[model samples]
Target: ARKNGRVGIVTLAKRPWLTESARIFLPGLDLEKLLDELQIPVFYAFEHVSRRVASFGTPNSYVAAKRNAMSECLAQLFGEAKQCSSAMSIGDSEIELLAIQELMSELAMSRFSTPLESPLQFCKTVLLRENPSLVQLQRQIESLANSLGSLVDHPGDLSLELGTGRRLRLRNHLGPNLR
Candidate 1:
C-alpha cells in the first residue's frame, strides 16, 4: 500500500481487531518515512472527523468554525487532487469516523423538527426578544382596547363603534329609560 502513490495511508496505533499479520506489519511500518517517500501530506486530525453530528453549535463558535474550516479544506484538497485516494489521510481512530458522522446526521434529521439555524436564530431572538415589532403592535392593540372600552358603556344604550378610518352609525337597540 505504501508503494502505491495513489493509496492514502492512515496509521492507527491501537486497533484491537487487527489481524495477527496486521499487528506484526503495523509495528514495522514507518508512517512518516513511507509518506515522505510517496510525497503525500498527512493531516493528523481526529477532532473534526470524530465530532458528534447532533451538536448544533453546542460546543462553541470557535470549535465549530475550526471544524467547518477543516472539513472544507479537506474537501477542497481531495477535490483538487490528481486521484481521489491520494488526497487525504487519517489516523486509526478515524476508521469509524465516516460511519459515525453518517449515523449522527440521520439521527439529527429524525430528532429535530427544524434545521438548527443557530446564528440567524440568535440574532433574531436578540433583536426581537418576544415580539417582532412590540412598540408598533402594542400601539395598535392599545388603540383597539380603548375603542372597545368606550363601547362598553351603559346597558340601556348599546353603541358599538368598529373599525378604523371609517365610522358606521349603529342605531340604539334600547330606549332612553329602561327602568
Candidate 2:
C-alpha cells in the first residue's frame, strides 16, 4: 500500500509447479514484463524478512487462499460463458428467422393467384403488414401462449414470477420465430 493510494510495492516469484495447461493458456503472460511495462515502483514484501528464519504459512493456508481466488475467477468465467451462450442462441435464431423470412417472401412473390375479396383476407393482409415472416411468427407465438402461459402462471393463484428466476417463462416471449 502507498500513502497516495495509487499502488504498493510488491514482488511475486513465479510458482514453479504451474501446470502445463496454465502455461499453454498464458503463454505470453510474463509477470516481470508486465510490471516493467506498468513502470510502477514495485518491490518484494518479503525482502526484509529472513526466509530461513521465518515460515509464516502452511500448505493448507496457501491452498485455501488460492482456492478463494480461483473460486472468484471461476465465477466470473461462468458468467461470461452464460452470456456467450445466450448471445450465440440469439444469433442462431436470427439466422434461422432470416432464412425463413427469405423463403416466405419468395413464396409470397412467386404466387400470382388472386386473393379472395373477404374481410378475413383483408384483415390478415393488414394485421400481418403483408410480411409473411411476421404472420408466421405471430401464429407460432399465439399457439404457444396458452400452454407456456399455464406453466409460467401459478396453477392455483395465477400469480406471475417477476425476476430472472422466470427467465424460462420468457422463452416464449422471444416469439415463435426465435424458438
* Candidate 2 positional error at 71, Å: 30
Per-residue lDDT tens digits for candidate 1, residues 16-122, read 32333344767877655655677654332333444453244433432333333334443444553211211111212222233223322333334345445211110
Which ten-residue region of model 1 has the weakest summed lDDT?
119-128
* Superposition error at 61 for model 2 (Å): 13
**Stretches of model 1 off by over 4 angstroms after superposition:** 2-5, 10-30, 47-97, 100-179
Off by over 4 Å in 2: 1-5, 9-25, 56-179
TM-score of 1: 0.23
Evaluated at residue 155, the lDDT of candidate 1 is 26
Q: What clash pairs does model 2 have?
A: none
What TM-scores do the predictions have? Answer: 0.23, 0.20
